[model samples]
Structures are given as C-alpha cells and as structure tokens.
Target: MSVHTACPVTTRKTLGQVLVCLGCCCGRTDKGHPPVPVDWLKSEWKRRMLPKKIHLSISGCLGPCDASNVVLILYGQEAIFLGGLHEETHYLALADWATDCDHQGCLVPLPESLEPFRLERFVDEPVAAGAA
Candidate 1:
C-alpha cells in the first residue's frame, strides 16, 4: 500500500537483505492463477538458514503491479527489484545471492543471467506524514 523510505530493520552496516513484498497487487490470484507462493518462500528461506540480517516480509504494496511478485535486495539507499518470480530457479538464485551477500557483509553483484529478471532501479518513496 505504501513504500518504505527506509527499511524497518535499520543497521549501521550493510548486510544480506531480501524484501519479499507479497503486497495486495500480488499473491493468491490476479485473474485466475496464483503468483509467488508465499509459503514456499518462507520455507525455503528457513531451510537455507539464511543470515540473521536478511530481512524478508510481506509489505502492503510496492507500486509496480505490472511487475508482480517483487523481491528486492536492498543495499544502503539502493535496491534491486526482481520481478515475475514464479519459478524454483529464481528462488535458488536468490538464495545463492543472499548467502554471498551475507558472507561479504554487503550486496553481492547479481549474475548477468538474472539481469533479465531485474525490474528497475528501486528508490524508496518518501512516506506521507500522518498517514500511518
């Protein structure tokens, strides 16, 4: 529903990050079928034992309906939006990337293969006052 100016988990140093926004625009069914199975995502994250700093949650909406099922890897003020995530391969890639970032204590470079899935350069919009 609203974009976050800053991540809820604010750390002084950059660490592994994954913002899985199963907003209103996403999940269950758009027209007929489901998108981005949320349960699978949660299970996979736990099974992988991803780093502690890896923040993942379902937000209201992140403003890109055309790019449904958005998953973001945040780094400081910048973020990488990966859209149309409906396959196991995509999740595996995400897990690998997160592990790498955790080890590096910073955002790891995304592979060229994943370049196509990238939605756009994400810049968090300022939150409106007295709207909470």
Candidate 2:
C-alpha cells in the first residue's frame, strides 16, 4: 500500500512567520503544561487571511524545553521569542497582533496583553573595546 499521496504545493509570499512549538513539553497537558489551542489558531489565521501576509507553522521541538508553550514570531530581521503562553487569551492576543500587522502592512508593537509573554532566549555578545 502506498502511504504517501501526491499533492500540489505552491510557494506563498509572506511578510513574516509565526511558529508554534508543540514539543514534548509544550501542548502536553498531562505534563502540567497548558494545552495549545491549535484548532483555534488555525481558524483565526485562515479567517484573518494571514496566509497572504504571515505564515503560520505548527512545529515540534523548538528547543528550550524548559520553556513550554513557546511561540516564535519572525518579522523582518528580528526573531521574537515568547514563552509561557498558557492561556486562551494569549492565543487570541497573538491572532490579534498578526491581524493588526497584516492590516498595517508592517510589523507593529505587541499589544499589552502579550507583553508579559515576551522572553529572551538568546543573547548577543558585546563587542570588545577597540577590537576592530
């Protein structure tokens, strides 16, 4: 039996991307982490027509397993890391943020509701004095 089926694939142009991590820790309610609202997110993304402006990908194991329920937003050259999104409101806020950015045709500041979820997983090294 053939397990795979062929399907048409089309490349989409998007202004940014949102990556939701459903890793071992994330989306595992049994492990004490909150459930990821995958269905709601997908519905919201489609309803808002975000596929044309923002690409949404539900991925697995985005690292930093310590921070469950992680979401990464890539806008331009910036990668924003958000963690501890354990609430339905957080997902709603994310949808809203993406919709606003799409409407404005550019990245916009994160709404207050999502401000608390912002996290810094990577840090840049400082340049040495007169090293160049």
Candidate 3:
C-alpha cells in the first residue's frame, strides 16, 4: 500500500508528471512487471491532473489470477483490465484511455485497435477479494 514514495522534499513535484517506476510498486509474481500500458496511461494524465509528478508503479497483486490481467488507474481511483490482450496493444490502449481521462471520471474511450481488451469494471482490492 505504501509503494508510492514522496519525492525528495527539496525538489518540486507535480500531479500529472508520473513515473511507472517499474517495480517501485509490485505484483506477487517473481516476474513482477508493472503493467506497462496502464503505467504509461497514468503518466500522460500529468497535463490534466497537473500532478506536478504523478507516480505509478505495480503494487501488490490484487489476486484472483483470473484478474491477473488487470491494472489500476489514477492511483487506484479506478481500475481496468487488459481484456484478452497481449502486451503490445494492451499497453497502448490503456495509456491512451487513462491519460485522456477527464475530471468527470470518464476516460476518452479506448482506441479501436484495443476495443477487445477493455474490461467493464475492476474489482476493488482485488487481491483481498480473492480475484482468482
């Protein structure tokens, strides 16, 4: 839960400027890879949220291996999925949708190529909920 770290106190940060930071957060697998597209999507939101520095990384796995093909968006405010996807198109669509999300909690809708991988909803604290 405490995966995200505050930037150096002396340095400045913004809301939108996020870094996926690789395994700064984590999943359960030994091969923990922060889902790339979701992380990429979050970083793009810096312009809108003006995070000054939005930070994204893989946190612990929200289980339900069924949901292993999952992702968190907007620092867990919303979660979505890679729906029957492979890394290439999956990451691209996620980044597109998340970064373009507006204040209304609505994302700009997924790209045509990624239409297949969109998940309707992401279960909360999926790991605890027994996502498998």
Candidate 4:
C-alpha cells in the first residue's frame, strides 16, 4: 500500500510521532499476538536519540484490538497505521524509518519493506446504521 496523504484526525505539522500499542490484544502473547520487543525498541529509540525529532509513545489500546502489534505513525500531515508487525526486522525498519526522517527533517515515504503492513484502519465515510 502507498502512503496516505490525508488523515481524518487532524492536519498538524509534526515532524513525526510513533505510537506502539501495548494494550489488550496488541502485545499480549496470550491473545495469540506476537510479543512486542519493548525493551529493544526503547533502547534503539534512545540510542538514536530519536526523541529530538521523532516522538515515541508506547501506549495502551490504540484500538482496533484485532489488529495486533499495532503501530500508528503520524508524520507531517499523514497518519500511517501498521499492524501484524511480529518480527524483529519490523522494529528495525521502524527505527531506520524514523532515523531517515529525522535526518531529513521532514516526513518521508515509509520503506518499501513496511508497505505490506500498512493498514486502512480509518474510513472517510461513516458506517451505515446496523452495519457490522
């Protein structure tokens, strides 16, 4: 999937922000979802000093609970939702993507490797009554 330029949430000029969900279904191995490498991710973020350019928040319940290992990335005017990230390489790619954006001082297209994980979690149209 290609990068989506518009996000229904808000259009704020942020360098970038990453939110990794650790709630209910996301990082819960008991829920049949793969484990999130919390410690490694934190260490990598700190090692790269990404906080200066990219905001990282390991949060609870970013919703869409079925989408385990969810990660929401807001960059510039776009919001990228990625799910099913169950590998170490996925986390590495996240760090690399953040580092690249930090070096560029702006938002950049997500690496091709991560395209498959892109999720269309938001919809422009409201759900019709009684739709499931």
Candidate 5:
C-alpha cells in the first residue's frame, strides 16, 4: 500500500493576527459552561477585532481552567489572547474585525451582542503589548 501525504496548505500573507485556537478544551465552569473551541479566544483582542492582514490558527489546549477555546493573536511585535466563544458567527466576526487593523493593535470595538464572552488577559503573559 502506498501512503499519501496531503500537500501543505500555505497562505499568501503573514497574517497580522496569528491566533492559537485551542481544541479539545475539557472541563466545565461554575455556571456549567464547557471549554472553548479550536476557534474560541480571548474576546477582547484589539487587533483581532479590526480588519487587517489577520491570520487565525486553530491549535491545541492553551492551558487554564476557565477558558476552553483559547485564541492567541500575534502580530510582529506583540500577542493577544481570547477565550470562551464557540459560535460560528463569532469566528466570522473575529475574522472580519481582524482586517485593516490599526498600528496600535488594539481591540476593535464589537457590537453589544458579542461582548459577554470576552477573555481575561493573562498578566503573566502580556498580550500584544509591543509596538503596534
């Protein structure tokens, strides 16, 4: 039998926001919430909220108790984290917001409907605190 290796999938541009979407998020919260998805992230990312050269990656567990789907946004200078969002629309919104972002790399203001599940910034790991 011949083994077939799938070709590598590559993008054209180096996405402005390189996110780490953690998969297989185990554990539930006090309010009975499940972990975040491979698409979930720290809801308050400044750069990710805007539309720019954004690249969202879905990876493995990001480490923590409360967060399920952890998103790690990365630019050239800094990085950001997000969590607890498991809906498809939210993912789309995040993607749309990550385009044409400002140099400051701040969280793009989102609609009221998508504000509750924002992530708690990891003080130990400062996010996107570098040159915007």
Candidate 6:
C-alpha cells in the first residue's frame, strides 16, 4: 500500500512543510472493520484547504503498532509523530500546527491539547528485556 508522487523542481521555495503519514494499523478496527479516520482526515485536509506542500501519505508501517492512526509531521529537522487521533478537533489542531510551523520556519511547541498525543520514537532497546 504505497504511492509515490513527483515533487516539483522548486520544492524548496514552498513554506508549507509537512509530511503526514497515516501509517498502517492505525485505521484497523477491533473486529476487522474498515479504517477509522483515514477518510475523515483526508476530508478535513481538503476542507481546510491546506497548502499543496503539506503532503499527505498513506504509509505501510511506522513501527508503532499500538499507536495506530499515526501522523508524522516533518518540520525543520524534527519529525513529530502524533498517534491516536480520531476526532475533528485533533484534525483541526494538525492544520493549525502545520500552518504555524510553515510560517515560523521551524517546529513550534505543540498546543497543550496536542501534547498528550505526541509520540517519542524509540531510540534504544531497554537494558532489562530479559537479555542475558
């Protein structure tokens, strides 16, 4: 489930900087139902009229199974992962954050409402995982 697009030659000139990754397993339901929020997110993006530079993608797997419905936002050198977003307010916050980041030239601190959804990527293996 991968789709690639051709970026324009002058991509750097765009101030809209966001890479939204709707990773695999995020939309899965408990009883093998259809995805939860993928369509809704897409609709919100269209409704909000976000910039074209803010690219949206449907990725295969993002290494965090528990954190389904993940959205990866790339601002400057930072990659912010927001998971478990299933509400309209969450979608709105994403747009707001991306717009602010684009104007600010870097990733600003996330709003208080979005703070809990932030996911810290695993850096290293735990020392006590029964590795003996």
lDDT of 6 by residue, 1-132 (tens): 434565455644444344444445666666342354556656766665655546556576677667766767665545778777766687678777666665676556788888898888767666787779
Cα lDDT tens digits, model 1, 24-129, are 7666475432376567767777776664656656566777767776777776667778777767677777777777776776677886667788886545686788
Q: Each candidate: what lDDT? A: 0.69, 0.88, 0.45, 0.88, 0.53, 0.64
RMSD (Cα, Å) for all candidates, in order, is 6.5, 8.4, 8.9, 6.3, 11.6, 6.8
Error of 4 at 41 (Å): 0.8
The estimated TM-scores of all candidates read: 0.69, 0.83, 0.39, 0.82, 0.47, 0.62
Give the CA lDDT, 0 to 100, for residue 47 in model 2: 89
Q: Model 2 TM-score? A: 0.83
Q: List the residue pairs that clash in candidate 1.
A: 1-60, 1-61
lDDT of 5 by residue, 1-132 (tens): 444566488756544655554444432334455544332444434335532345455555566536655566675556556666666666666655554344435545554544675665657755675746
Give the top-scoring candidate (TM-score).
2
Q: For model 2, how does the per-residue alpha-carbon lDDT over 1-132 read when each residue is reduced to its tens digit?
A: 564566477666587999999988999999999999999999989988997798999999888778789999997668988999988999999999899999999889999988888888875776788988
Worst 10 residues of 1 by lDDT: 25-34
Q: Give the C-alpha miss distance for residue 20 in model 3, angstroms.
A: 9.0
Query: Candidate 4 on 54-97: residue-level lDDT in tens?
Result: 88899999877777899999865678899999998998999999
Q: List the residue pairs that clash in candidate 2.
A: none
Candidate 5 regions off by >4 Å? 1-15, 26-52, 100-115, 124-132
Model 2 lowest lDDT segment of ten: 1-10
- Please tell me which model should have the higher lDDT, number 2 or number 3: 2
Q: What is the lDDT of residue 26 in candidate 3?
A: 30
Q: Lowest lDDT 10-mer window, candidate 6?
A: 11-20
